[model samples]
Target chain A: MEATTEARVPQKLTSKGRATRARILEHAAELIYTKGVHATNNEQLRRAAGVSGSQLNHYFPTKESLVLAVIEWQAERVLAFHRSERFAHFESLDSLREWAGFYIAYEHSYREGCTLGSLASEIIKTDLDVRADLANAFEQWKDLFRDGLERMQRLGRISAEADPARLAHLLLSAFQGGMLLAQVARDITPLEDALRAAIDHVQTFAVLPAADAPEDR
Target chain B: MEATTEARVPQKLTSKGRATRARILEHAAELIYTKGVHATNNEQLRRAAGVSGSQLNHYFPTKESLVLAVIEWQAERVLAFHRSERFAHFESLDSLREWAGFYIAYEHSYREGCTLGSLASEIIKTDLDVRADLANAFEQWKDLFRDGLERMQRLGRISAEADPARLAHLLLSAFQGGMLLAQVARDITPLEDALRAAIDHVQTFAVLPAADAPEDR
Candidate 1:
């Protein structure tokens, strides 16, 4: 069976096939977000993606590999969302409040709330590698907020002694807690109230040293 | 397999046997806190507790029930810890800072930290009953903090306009956030830094209103 080199060689896929693979990953993320990675399997993923059975098998030989792909996709999405200068654009706590309103509303309504957080929670029962991946993603997120807070402090928009890393951790935990409560209640009220109150505390209590902070970044 | 007249029913025997059960639960909590709930099992729990396999089974029946018992134990302990006057000693933010320090240090070193919270995070990935139990525990905790905050507000120690329940949510989330960060690092540094900043913010910025405002109780 291994005598012929050309027969054993893998063939490169067409553009459509590559697009189909990305579509499967996107759909897989949705399933993983809602149903959890362990609960979502190949058959469900195939049906959800509208791909044939053979196609899914062709791309990901195992569900774990597909889940890892979804995890990576979610990592990229969250990392990008945080780094899009949204945190930097805030003029003050008031502006942050406004941004928080938008954030809570959109997050609760769409985007599976938080795929990576859900993955982290889910994998605590199942996979070690996936848990590590999720943890790494969380660390990366904390770094983004830490960097933003440092810049704010240097510009006199925040106190020199302010701990950006801590605030970043606080922010991420608020979202996780809200998601947890929201999932339990099957209502958005907990998430909304939690977000509103959390942001208010951060705004009222976050240390801003300079009286004359710049409005434009 | 015939029963002896009245006593196939088993004797309510020695205090030593009862003591063994308590010891097992304590060690289960320890393992769950350090290695996580999913990673801890009956054989391991028995070995760590210095109890026999039969004794472990006599006490806990199943792994799920054992974890649930650990949770119930934690619920009682945490609630008792936060009882009014006990926790109310933390009246101002400065006191809150000291409290935060002691709290995190105790948490990291407290012979397996928080059993209920650890079990809850792991259980979120699984059964409905487990999720319901965790949700109930979280709500109960939030209520405990709310009551404490409300009492402080009633004593004119905090802002009358303060949302006691909301602040409770914020504080709990912040606590969880610190724990999670520390969990990943397998160290208490994140918990220390986060709680320090959070308590500092509360002290300096969360001032009370004039006595004329209505009590929120």
Candidate 2:
């Protein structure tokens, strides 16, 4: 049985070493997301990253460590997208709908879905520590949505009666669930429907005349 | 690559043979859910079912066949619960709430989750045929929710403007997403919040004063 332990990273690297590590992380994330952690062995990762066996071992001593690093890497990528300029605030109904569209509009490759979510489903089968890392990723992702919803509430776009925290969870779960169903069914309709449902749910709490009412302005 | 073909079951079985098959499937499902499909070997299954090696092969022939059988078995179990006396018809708001509560009420064991969902997550990594079967199971499950919503619509409890099929997908996705998050987090809060959000969405389209209206009767 694998121990429930946190991943350890080696600090202090040269610039070239840092680039090599980033390259390996990039390739490893793709391999793990595409073919699951158990299926993607160290040799396969070494070849994919164009790294030697020693280098692979130096960065990630075990497959479990690589999986953990990939989780962190993917989490950062997802959060970065949400924190990007267009989606940064997520303070308006328009942006929220656009966010939903962003997910649904993408044409997925075969066997492709949310990177972190796919990893979570596979990783949850094994260790609690890994699962906890994933759970934390989800919590961070949920917080982004919550921050936006709270912003909207303060601006009077969303009603004070609605709980942003609960609504944020609904949005995150909707995305996770939609991705799972969409991936399994090989159809994006489930994802579209799920995201639409969540957005519609959020709209129910929208204050009327959310238009250009310049009361505060 | 595994062939994208459907599973084939033997046409004939004696009473004892059927019982043995059922016993094997029951045990296989338990092992598969707990330890994942890729991790559970045939030897482990034979031991778990207390069957001889030949006996296992006589029933399943291949591991893929066993997995397909387990998917069907778990689907039947889920559908049966929804089709049972208390949940049969599922034609009211109160019953819908009960259904949501049903999932949240259960205390899942360590590494335990939705039987078919866990299977689907693992099975999707291998074969398209297996994924299609899991997709069909989800379709049937979604149909159950749609059936109830349609019934409520006919009874004037649900608004004519609402789409039962879409709403059903929402409900199913919420449950799926909720379970995925709950399993990873080892907490039912995400599931609880998701179901409540979905139910609230459904209520937005509900017909007010859906009480004992004698005119409809």
For model 2, name the residue pairs that clash. none
- The true-versus-predicted C-alpha distance at residue B16 of model 1, in Å, is 7.0
TM-score of chain B of 2: 0.89
For model 2, state the Cα shift of residue A22 in Å. 1.5
**Which prediction has the highest lDDT against the true structure?**
2
TM-score of 2: 0.91
* lDDT (Cα, tens digit) per residue for candidate 1, span B1-217: 0122113213674678666767887898778767776677777887899888888878777777777667766766666666546456455554556556666777463323345654565555554355555566678777866776676777667667777776666666566655655665556766666566545444443544555446743
Q: Worst ten-residue run, lDDT, model 1 chain A?
A: A1-10
Task: For residues B1-217, write the lDDT of model 2, one tens digit per residue.
Answer: 0122222445587778878888998999898888888778888988988999999999998887888888888887887788887775778878889988888888862237788776777657664357877888888888888999999889888898888877887887888778888888888888888888988898898886635555666
Badly placed stretches (over 4 Å) of model 2 are: A1-8, A210-217, B1-8, B109-111, B210-217
TM-score of each model, paired residue for residue? 0.72, 0.91
Q: Report the Cα lDDT for residue B186, model 1.
A: 52
